[model samples]
Target: MKKIKYFYNTNTLRYEKLVTPLRVRLLRVFGFVSALLVSSALVIWVYTRFVPRPTDKVMEYRYNSMKENYATLKSEVKTLQDQIAQLEKRDNEVYRSIFEANPVPDSMRVKLIEKKKELDKVEALNDDQLSNEIANSLNNIAARISYQRTSYDGIEKLINNQEAKLSSIPAIQPLSNKDLTRIASGFGMRIHPIYGIPKMHNGLDFTAPQGTPIYATGDGTVTTAGVGNGTGNHVIINHGYGYETVYMHMVRIKVRDGQHVKRGEVIGWVGSTGASTGPHCHYEVHINGSPVDPVYFFYNDLNAEQYDRLLKLAATGSAKSFD
Candidate 1:
């Protein structure tokens, strides 16, 4: 260690100790602290950026599951589509050709082909992609809506009463993939979440955020669009041909009674208004005014496993939060 040197004062003839200046001491301290902070910041950045986060792992797992499910759905859709095409071919060869009636235009078939191309291009859809895919599909549907009401109104003149060109019934989902949500509860008998008693749940409960848009599964006229018993702010559509769809627990209703709505048209939003559980949509399908399983009819784009899971979830979901 070096000792501090002292200076001798000739006037007083005394030894005086040499001291460092205040500014220099302060600068040294500031520099050390600045280096330490920089090193710590680098270490944190490396750890957070390089290491896997929990959310990432979970998302990866979900994405993998969705990919598998989507693959299965794609196959099923292809098979169903092949069956439909075969049926249409049979209709044209055996039925339409006999009367020399032209089958539906290739424009509609071309749209279907475009949709299939879009579906094939999607390997796995993330949340945003899934939302967009659904939105685009619905928008496409809305943009190219035919064979719904216009076909039914003047059916005698359209295609000589051909059933192949008409898809008037509710064959698709009221809530498509974009608005698809986790099952809150399902149809059939279950213990009431609130009342705590054995009861029959007439619809599939979809857990969604407030203000999530709800759509009409098929082309229909709004038969009922107001608050009802137990269900809050509900909308019921009459698809004719003895088919009806009921959407309950709406935050807001976009249509009024007697108003016509096409498939994929927005009608309402998810809400916790009526029976009072949480934000969700309670959906029901009816045939001749009798409630039927809504889950069976949502075959718009779900894979088999996803559809099966929906059925399973409805069957095995907890008996809670139905209103």
Candidate 2:
């Protein structure tokens, strides 16, 4: 503290104490402040240039971690897209095939593709690829679910149509299976029992005792109920949709012309009437007025194996129609 200042006063006598000027003192203070600031700046520069900081390292690590996660998410999104395609494939192959329905229209699938492309564009705009990829995956899942719901709705409509078609088509035995002892004859060429000549049977014959209840095989209106020259007391049902059924050689007809009958309803009773040699019902299934083998139409009531046996039995049968 004793180090003396040396500013001489002009008006003082020789060897007088020196007083510092206000301007010089102010200049010195300004110089000291400038030096302090410069030194502090230098120290800060050296520390930042030579020493590592946790904040910078953490930022870099977070960036790298996010990149790795984004890669994984990208792979996951691709897998989900592949899975969605597979689901669409199955919807067409299995579900649509059963109902004879066409698959989703190309335009619909194209719209879905376009929407995905738009979503991907949005994903690309994001700086964080992981978030983008996750968003894309969620969008893809939601879109596919929506598409699948629409397809399922269409499939449901097709299923309802198929059910109606099934109901309209013949499905059950014209007579009770318990009362049916055997198929006396099947459609195809066979020697006529009464004529003693080969003729197309054009129907199936189920031999039963007289007065056995004969049931209608499907839902329809009776178109004809009268005696045919050879069909005996027959009833012909006009089931719309190019389908019709005939029951012949009945002792009595319970259904009159224009009467509606459901499947398994008693329409007549079996008898040896007309030119029939025995008591049996001549059952026929006509599709578009063309006769198809009646045994093949019973798949609704029989399994594949049982149907195969029945088919085989009809194939090897050698009996003639009683009518």
Candidate 3:
């Protein structure tokens, strides 16, 4: 191969020809290109080893932050689960006490037992060992909600039972004060006014003038409010829950059968209409068809001193007939 070169002399303004090898010039160009490639490779390698790329640094930082956040969330969930368990235990104790105080309905008791089983199942979970705190918290929350609902149901049942019991008790005076004057006769063994023989008396007799008011002992329905053979002008009230009150020897009946009567409501006036010796009210309390002392039932309305005095009087009093 042939090569040509030119030289210039500035002072003489002349050109000169020089000789060079074509192979040598080709080799020199190849060498320069190779050196340039090697330098580029060195730069790339240095960048990959030490100088971090923007996208790579961002990705690394994001991964580390995610790990830290996951750890914190797991710890918080564990704490919440512990608190829930404690609250559920306390609720169980309260419910147990309420159940003992007032018997729970069978259906409610079954539901409460089921809720307790569910709580036990949640407590038995060992997911904390596997670091599954989220699952544990979710289960604990569900158990707590179920327990709370069951407790509310128990309370409602207890309230309903108490209300029923309270409704059954006689809480009002059977006769008005105007109609309740002196006692014409006492309860227990007494001489019958009409028969003139020793007999059992199951009620108290109140002497009052005619046209006096007679009140109901409690809220009830007037089952029978008319004259009978021996109890003329009678009023029988069914106060529910195995309690029945009888008002005999009334002057005149004011309420009809099947009439709804409230506490302190007037059913009749005072009178001695039947086998009585004088104008008076015959008040009696029958529990499940058996007569009980009416004075004991009125203890709730009496003060401490009044109740004690009345008890003393009852202990000292003897069966005497007003006739």
List lDDT for all candidates, in order.
0.76, 0.82, 0.73
Give the Å error, residue 242, model 1.
0.6
* Tens-place lDDT digits, model 2, residues 1-323: 77775654566744555677899999999999999999999999998998878997887888897888778777767877786787678677766668688755667888899999978877667566547656676777868777886787787787777777678788887776633346778789988999999999888888888999998888889999999889889999988889999999899989899998887789989997888888888999999999999997886667777777777777767666687
Worst 10 residues of 2 by lDDT: 7-16
Q: Clashing pairs in model 2?
A: none
> TM-scores of the models, in the given order?
0.50, 0.54, 0.58
Candidate 1's C-alpha runs over 4 A off are 1-166, 178-181
Model 1: per-residue lDDT, tens digit, 1-323? 99888888888899988677999999999999999999999999998899989999998988897777677656655755665565556556554655788756658888999879877767577665774575575545444333332443464354543342234466666554533456767788867767888888888878778988888888888999999767889999998878889999898999999999888899998898877678888888999999998878877657777777677766787666466
Candidate 1 clash figure, as a count = 1
Which one wins by TM-score: 2 or 3? 3
Could you tell which candidate, 1 or 3, scores higher by TM-score?
A: 3
lDDT of 3 by residue, 1-323 (tens): 66677888687788877555799989999999999999999999999899999998987887686677568766766766676676556556655666655445669888999989867876876544323544565567667766776776687677687776666567654554422234556567877766778888887766678877988877788999888878889999998888899999888999999998877778899887877777778888999999986767655456667656554554444455433
The alpha-carbon lDDT assigned to residue 278 of candidate 3 equals: 74
lDDT leader = 2
Q: How accurate is candidate 3 locally (lDDT)?
A: 0.73
> Could you arrange the candidates by TM-score from highest to lowest?
3, 2, 1
Off by over 4 Å in 2: 1-158, 178-180
